[model samples]
Target: MEPGTVRPGGRTARVRAAVLEAAGDVLAEQGFAHLDLAEVARRAEVGKTTLYRRWGTVTALVTDLLEDMAEQSVPRTETGALLGDLTANARLVRRTLTDARQGPLFKAVIAAATCDERTAAALRRFYEVRIEEWEPCARQAVERGEIPAGTDTREVIRAVSAPLYYRFLLDGGLLDDEAAVRAAGAACAAAKAGAFTTDTARPRSSDR
Candidate 1:
């Protein structure tokens, strides 16, 4: 336990916060291939040994960052109506993906996940946590009879976001308030139609 390398008490948390912030900056600016732990240590003003001991590799650092992001995500908006709640979820996704800082950071992580197995798992877990966070809104809708009794709550939540993500990362389409509302409306309509009903899921035809 070297004095400078080993943080005491509250400094451990502070060191993590600083290191994560520096790592995010590197990812947002140049993506993962360019993420050097030494550079991150310099930028974070943390000791290089400490950085190495704590995170070891860029992948580990990014995984921890994703975990923190999932833990700190905004709480679900409870509107008491399926459409209203879904619309809120849609708008929130649009807003986050459009943020100057978050947009690039997310794009970087997504690209990294495409080729890196560990990153892919971390990214998957991040979305799973987020979807679960907002899953309750759809469950409430089910209880209210706004949607079918067997509606897949998490799927309904994912439906509200899938389009916005496509526009942001694939189609390069506009993600405005109108688009959010429309997306939410379509998902809400589909939910009411049993599109996401667990018991009513369509059995797959074997051939592709």
Candidate 2:
């Protein structure tokens, strides 16, 4: 099919969806260095001209993928209890990090971000979007008196995933249910203890 021909539905959207899926597959299996436009187009069964005309560069493609991921990500679940909310968040992270296909894709994207400024910025935005999604859980906890009024909601949300990412990216340790539960429990305890509050004391520089 020609790029100029309009489809019944959203032709541009369908092309973008196909291209991104192919890009993700290449990134997961072959990493960023192997993700060329011509190859992605071939894999996606799309025209190379279409991909080049649309994305122009691999960085743009990756950035667009991240944006799409952020948009399509699951919404947060409310479990009434802060621990329950946190547990749900932690488990979701753990599951993604452990997924056979998704795990490799995430690892590849993170590795690429280290060397590419555009990718790094996109990665940061992706995390910020994810954090924003879950931060409301902490806010709700504050309203319920489960946590302090001045709590840093974003920080609390980060706390739930930090340990899992640490293991997934660095430690190479197990990301089991136990780890997920522990992460949530620790974050919840810290929130309850005012560790995430804006007024939480900081040690003097000399004391460090």
Candidate 3:
């Protein structure tokens, strides 16, 4: 690399981050319907040609933003128990979903994803990353004998956030620490009862 030129990985990562930050600001201020590539490039301080070359379409730009958001999220922590780890996960998710700016930004991105295939794929990838981040906590619980050995780590992690996302996006319920605790408790009880132990099986109806 030249003295002033960034390495490929470093430059690409920085440019992507800058673009996503600009995109988030644009979405928050003007909504997705008003998003413009030229404006985003101006805000990010990168050339419009560069932005267009890197992300071919508006959908691609939004997709990249979602991927960046997922990559930037904090990882889960181990607390030596399933419930504790789940509770922490819930709190972290709740905090993000309930934030004034982030909440609206996410709503815009999700709405855009619903209509754009590329954006939808990116959204799914984002969820996959988050699921992977928390899967280890559930895996650890199983290894420690706190939950069934065959528990579905992905499902358990998903369960912890499903209700939280539903409440935020659909029901308009309050997203708070208390809600996080309730979600964690529900996921933990279901996990303990082997509701998430089998592949190709739905969570036990009793868990609902």
lDDT of 1: 0.86
Error of 1 at 145 (Å): 0.4
Candidate 2 residue-wise lDDT, 1-208, digit = tens? 2222222248777888898899999998998888888999999899998987778889888888888788788889899999999999999999888988778989999999999998899899999999999999999999999997788889999999999999999998889999999999999999998888774454345766
Off by over 4 Å in 1: 1-9, 199-208
Whose TM-score is higher: candidate 2's or candidate 3's? Answer: 2
TM-score of every candidate relative to the true structure: 0.90, 0.91, 0.87
Q: lDDT for every model? A: 0.86, 0.88, 0.85
Put down candidate 1 lDDT per residue, 1-208, tens digits, no spaces: 2222233468788888888888889988888889899999999998999878877778888888888788788888998798989999998888888888888999999999999998999999999998998999999998998887877899999999999999989997898999899999999999998799875453345621
What TM-score number comes out for model 3? 0.87
In model 3, the runs with Cα more than 4 Å from the true position are: 1-13, 199-208
Give the worst 10-residue stretch by lDDT in candidate 3: 1-10
- Clashing residue pairs, candidate 1? none
Report the lDDT tens digits of candidate 3 across residue range 141-191: 989988887788899999999999999999988888999999999999999
Cα displacement (angstroms), candidate 2, residue 128, comes to 0.6
RMSD in Å for candidate 1, one decimal? 4.9
The candidate that achieves the highest lDDT relative to the unseen native structure: 2
